[model samples]
Target: MSKANKESLSVGTKIEYRKDFKDIYLPKTMPVIIDVPKMKYVMISGEGDPNGEEFARVSEALFSLSYAVKMSYKSNEVPAGYYEYTVFPLEGIWDLVDKSKPATDKSNLKYTIMIRQPDFLTDELFDRFVKRTKKKKQNPYLEKLTFGEIAEGLCCQIMHVGSFDDEPESFARMEAFCEEEGYVRSDYTHREIYLSDPRKTEVTKLNTVLRFAVRRFR
Candidate 1:
């Protein structure tokens, strides 16, 4: 089982392959954790299904938008220091997008939308994200763009069950499982490729893929 798949089931959850995201820049592929300021998006955050409309909007942005993405090596954080977003061999990132309102109270109000780093964004990329947000006028935030280095190597990951609120318990279990198997965390940041939008999904059915970069200790 792959790191992501194995982790998903260990916590009693199911994860399906969305698709194979690839690019022509194969060997030069860079992973980045970004600091995207609260910016607006075309699809508004709602309840019951984040993947409902907002995802379509973003899908259009990443795969449909004519703009290119940015790439870098390190967390978007200032000074770039964190132990949670460094999972490699899978391209981990600490994405920070500032949303008008957080999906949950625990989310960083000033910073929202955390995803993988070293994106393939070009100059007009963020401009497009903003354009999408302009579709809604109720509340506004920016998607600030910052870059981080792309850590490399093999990784083990899992898709978590339940709400973002339930991450702690799953994390604990996953940690123990990895450790028992003789795998050690690289102190890389804990990362989640959020599939279900917290705003639009039920707390019980949320989908978050958690991944940690593991390497054999020398």
Candidate 2:
């Protein structure tokens, strides 16, 4: 069914809560499609954690995303993952593109820094643009220094309880709020800020704030 015809969340303008998706957990490397549980999350935006920024890592994501687009210009699909993504600047400790690797049951599901603009990737124009950054040239991700201009719109957040696999319900709460708010989903991005790392804490009681971005409708 067409999403436009159905009532989606209003995002920022008229915030409320709803069950927008059956599953919301996005795999690090691929798009998620399944009957997943729902969880809580809130959406908002502004200057976030700056002192602890990761730059070199971001640069790597930019380069990697560029490479992926360039490689998949002819077809509509990519090798193991999907094309085009919406990325957001998340708070707390974060990993950069180069160093930010996603490890799990799927090895290829690594996080890649990418821009949503599709025109920038076409081989019909910028094929050579993707080749210059050889493996040796890629720089390691380093802590970013947030000094100046930082602009962000909306973010969806929710206090997550338990494991990452069990977070769809909380997200539904946030999505419903977005719809009632009249805020359009910018297709901006989804960021999971780690307040407590599960690796170090009890799996039964992990804390995280899943957030997304949005903007008020004109």
Candidate 3:
């Protein structure tokens, strides 16, 4: 780690992924194999291009509800395991609507967009935030958001520092790694974690973590 990266880490009261899960979040530009444990998230599902209006609506809804939960902890009541931490980067599980076709086909994509949650987040507490956010925003998309846990298990991952359109090159590295390691890509959607704000960052400078679920060849 660079001196700047190490200097930025605090002793405590941090939810930085780079500090905690360096292998998973701060992966090298080259592919690396890793294990992802089960984790909780606030998620919503949709189909078609991620650049479409529906995707925007869902993204807005997730952020709205997530902030609602944060504010609730700040003012009303902090949960049992509540701690000061950054809201997780937006992530997505992407696949093709037509299973037979390539998952990369942008026009027929299916995705479950999500933001990771703290361990203290409970179903009851999540419900309260949902109700609170709904009352404030009155967005129908809020109803689609749900809380759940997912175990991605073993996988190959890499940091793709370019436009989303360039992810195939990164995935190519992961694919080669899997093939040489005698692993088979699992029947799970490819996962991407956005580390840069697309609205502000240049496409070539976008930082994204790409992961593929995999298991040993059997």
Candidate 4:
């Protein structure tokens, strides 16, 4: 191939989460223990059912900001460390506001939804992206957006296929795996990474990464 062809290929290549972070993003259906590293994200917090309008708005805001950073090179002044990368999938740290409610009760759910930013995204760059996104888009949830690092540390994760409502079956399997492996869940909250777009994919074809922090039995 010519040098120009090579350059085109390099620029076209995107860093895919499944290919680059297989242990974290692409796991087998069976639960496994892994140490998650700290990573940066553009995040927004909200409550109530994820199917509701608020959740949609929060997700939209996060993606808008993430894409702004990913496509910054198109702008006149690119970020110093900017590089080509695919926008990371949307992830959520989920919990319930009312402990008495079962996980099936979506109304009590509270969550922080986020999209992972590329390593080149700094706090300063994040602020600039947010500002640029706000000007380009009119999402009210933009004000709720924040940029930070999250380290999941030791955790158990599994790939879940099927409907989001069917996740408890996978979580149950994860709990059983942890019990057999001498580890226990460390918190009530759990994380979900959406690999397939729910709006576009069928319920039975959805792919999600289900994970929760864990530690060796005391």
Candidate 5:
């Protein structure tokens, strides 16, 4: 979209992914197949239990840089193709260090936490924002952040509403769906898009989008 067109658009227009791509974001309770196109994100990698302090610190660092970039555009120094938009929610791609192990053993999980960026953001722009954010405060994890595009291709996804510990119920349904549809779950671990803030939302009310990469069997 042109700058003039973006400017004239409503405040809601900034986040094209949220509005334009509901299949990937707002999936239904029943499993549905969708293709996730390539999209850019600011991501950081880490290991340990998700309920630990390290996970919290990693999340903080990502949000810090994301907010810095947003404020930069909103303030005096806006990057080219900058437009007003809502910040995307937190997302994670999780995997077990030992592929043989089940997901129930989460203590040794490896994860990449990320927040999506607008398509207009460039590598140079991302680096500048990183430096700008670092100068403001000292965060060792800042150096671990990487910006890149991920194309998850075809996936089966559903909206899971409940506590994190209760996700097994949803996973069971997804596994059954895969079996019924003749699709094999890929090695790629499940990806989660957090739609609710755990800090504020009740456990039973938590909203999470669960997705798994899959391939069809002949």
Candidate 6:
């Protein structure tokens, strides 16, 4: 972990990533470049339409583990560096299984859905919580969970508000912005941080942070 992140965890105050790292999680509507720090996450990979039953199961498994860590204070063994904080929102890195397939083909999509973990969560602690959650929750997807870190060095991002299908419009604006700034998207894949729950929120009101790696135009 970076010194700043380590310090944030050791302070014992509630660390809300949304409030602290708003630039990354809650970006402005217009595209901008930012350096995303490395952070640990509990992730599950699967290929299929995100709206399918299997996707829901994978998402549930991630939340089950995240909540276990959040509510660990009530448990007999609190984590070594436990602190009060809201659970991070669900995020996904999306791609297509077949390059020839268009983005509109949901069934051809591949994704790794994940929820970010607090800085204090260690590899050993993650395993303990996973084991504990497995016993408490009967979700088979829990076994597929893996813990790791991701560092998106420099990226262009924008706050996309509206239906998921309308994302291409936002991406077009982002790509245009990159071109104006002498940068270009580094890959076809992109990351989305879902700030609104589709189950409770209206499609037009959904807030998603759309981001992709970028490099200076060579």
Q: Pick the candidate with the highest lDDT.
A: 6
Please provide, for model 2 over 35-148, each residue's C-alpha lDDT reduced to its tens digit, 9 standing for 90 to 100: 222221111122322222443355444445344444442343332322333332223322233335442222222232222223223333233333433333454331221111
Write the residue-wise lDDT of candidate 1 on 20-132 in tens digits: 23111121112312222232222112223333454334333332221222211221311111111221111123322444544344333221233332233333444554455
lDDT-wise, the better of 1 and 4 is 4
Q: Tally clashing residue pairs in candidate 5.
A: 0
Please give the distance, in angstroms, between residue 129's alpha carbon in candidate 6 and its true position after superposition: 0.6
RMSD of 1: 15.8
The deviation in Å at residue 5 for candidate 1 is 39
Better of 2 and 6 by TM-score: 6
All candidates: CA RMSD (Å): 15.8, 18.0, 6.4, 3.2, 3.2, 4.7
- lDDT for position 38 in model 3: 94
Error of 2 at 121 (Å): 33
lDDT (Cα, tens digit) per residue for candidate 6, span 1-218: 34564455557667787788899888989999998889899999999999999999999999999999998766666677778899999999999999897999999999999999988899999999999999999999999999999998899999999999999999999999999999999988999999999999999999999999999995
Which parts of model 5 have CA positions greater than 4 angstroms off?
A: 1-12, 100-102
The candidate 4 region of ten consecutive residues with least summed lDDT is: 1-10
Candidate 4 per-residue C-alpha lDDT over 35-136 given as tens digits, one digit per residue, 9 for 90 to 100: 999999888888899998888888888888887887777666666655677789999999999998898999999998888888878888878888889999
C-alpha displacement of 94 in model 2, angstroms?
A: 11
The deviation in Å at residue 211 for candidate 1 is 1.2
lDDT of 2 at 123: 35
Model 6 ranges off by over 4 Å: 1-12
The TM-score that candidate 6 achieves is 0.93
Give one clash count per candidate, in the order shown. Answer: 45, 48, 0, 0, 0, 0
In the predicted model 5, the residue pairs found to clash are: none
How much is 87 displaced in model 1, in angstroms? 22
